[model samples]
Target: MWKIICLLSAVNTAFAGVEKNFVNFGGFVCPREEKALGRCLRDALNTYIPQLATGVAEYGVPPCEPLLIPALSVHQTAGPFAVTSSYTDVTVQGPSTMRVKDVTVDSEQQEIVSKLYIPELKMKGNYKLSGQLLMLPIEGEGHFSGKYGDIDAVVTITLGRAARPSGPDALTCEALDVKFHIGHAALQLDNLFGGDGELGNAMNKFLNENWQKLSDELQAPLEEALREFLKPLADHAFGMLRADDVLGGP
Candidate 1:
């Protein structure tokens, strides 16, 4: 998520004068002046949020409204519980509503930093798990749902340039890092303990009650997943233009 924000900031610069080639990007380019770069980027991102949600097929970017993630696996062995869980066919909603609170670009260092907030996000999928929770045996294969709100994320992107045979050096994503906090979360896993309704309900209650701890435990993996997801998108967008064209002009 953090990566998404920073990448979008960089992509905004690439959109300068892109209207002639990509009509959807018209009117969304930020001014090249360093002084106005950050604010202009924030506004540009906000304006393009809707189009991005629906996707820009010409750019090979997928729709984000119900972002489809093939699978996610998490293994937690710290604290009082150890669990191995995998989710498939996951669909996430709410990123389209994200707002860029702030952005800073350091052209000299080729780094982009941004703060973003999402009002709420919901994820639904099928999950399979086996392990122990609170020293109790736990295992399940069923539908799962999660709702998260007030998500605040800080993202940093380190940019580099790649040699292009026919044009100026193209922009590349060298490294990306993201840190996030969720103000609240609610989770549910149906059909726990072989369809034991009591156990399933109790587990759901426990998960929601201790969501902060669980979220913390899962943060690293989640961040990694987000970074992986954004890298390709960033690369695809940046690969189309030269670094000089995007960031070196007046």
Candidate 2:
């Protein structure tokens, strides 16, 4: 009788995947279905994508006043002295409609691929520009806040083949690689300036007239911010899940 009981226990351990339990996501749940793991994981991700609105997102550059002017001329010296921006209330637009594009798993290679689509990253914030625009020394502040549209990124994560779970429930999984990219973006600066209303309006007009140049100047900084935003986003989505969630229990 003792030998039979030990043999039965070993058999159960060998076939654990066939009778595994569902994985939990803060509240979301995914069944441990080996054949349809990709879809299950994708569903789990969509359920947890709404946690991006709890903090301030900031971007800046040293001696930033010049970042607004298009580097069109080599002899141009007049530009803003400093520029800084901070945004808050950052939330995923269209949470109901947002979805994870796809998820792929390779047990042979111990890897997972996830695609996340964000309809928009909406936020409201303010920016200040303090510097000399001309020999006369002029500075202006603007409402540099708006919604960025159609942002998406793909994350590739690798699992350790020889790694073991630290506990009975925990799984050994880590994000080996994360890549972030942005599709479309827009900015609004209609109301900028604290003290000099007339000067602010004048600066706004100039920025509106040369908006393309301004956009060009801002591309790098904008990309930097997007990348920064993706880090937390990825952590929220991928960092919470463990190896058992994706590959079943050992």
Candidate 3:
């Protein structure tokens, strides 16, 4: 997740019309005196934000799998059950609108900070679980879907010169590091472990009751998953332009 944010920021200056304004990284000489560079970055984001929010970015298993329940112990009126399950073939539906509140640069630190609002994120996948429900054998395979609401995150990105010098103008930047913190995130599970819908609904109720704890447990894995999911897309898009050409600089 951090790397994704860093990579995204590193290419901001590569957006068309902003390359000439050599970012004031440490002590780089910027020829352009105007604020077009800032505008360029914002414009680039505007174009992508809408695309990501409304676009259907497809992903496959091995990379994106259904949410797995590490462990679940529930006491129901019918009975108690402890279970573990795995989901595969995941699909993520991005928000309808991804709003970027602001993008600020700390030249000295080479960091770009941004505030973003995601209206919603929807996901669906298939799952298989083997466990005991009401002390009875519960093994099944079915479909599950979930939606995250009003997510807000703060992303910080640090960029630096590419490790190897290649461009004729020696204008290339790479993502050095990135930090992403989610401020407010709410998730709702429509159906999970829905072998027949009843079990799934019951599980959803259990999850809602222990949402915070579950979130904490899944945070690390979720971050790793997000990073893997976005890396290829970032690389493909960033490869399309060179900083010098985009900036119209020597």
Clashes of each: 0, 2, 2
Best by TM-score, which number? 1
Candidate 1 ranges with C-alpha deviation above 4 Å: 1-35, 57-60, 217-229, 236-241, 245-250
TM-score against native, each model = 0.77, 0.48, 0.51
Q: Write the per-residue lDDT of candidate 1 for residues 1-250, one digit (tens) a residue.
A: 9999999988887765453233122344545444466676667666655566688687787776677778878888988779898888887777777788887878787877878888987878898988877787888999988888888988787878898888668778788888899888888899999899998898888888887867754464346545654566556655664566445732
**What CA RMSD would candidate 1 show?**
10.3
Candidate 3 lDDT, 42-105, residue by residue in tens: 4455555454433425322132232223323222232354555565665655532556666564
Task: Evaluate all candidate structures by whole-model CA lDDT and list the values in order.
Answer: 0.72, 0.50, 0.47
Q: Candidate 2, residue 241: CA error in Å?
A: 4.8
Best by lDDT: 1
Cand. 1 TM to true fold? 0.77
> How does candidate 3 score on lDDT?
0.47
**Cα-based lDDT at residue 112, candidate 1:** 72
Ranking by TM-score: 1, 3, 2
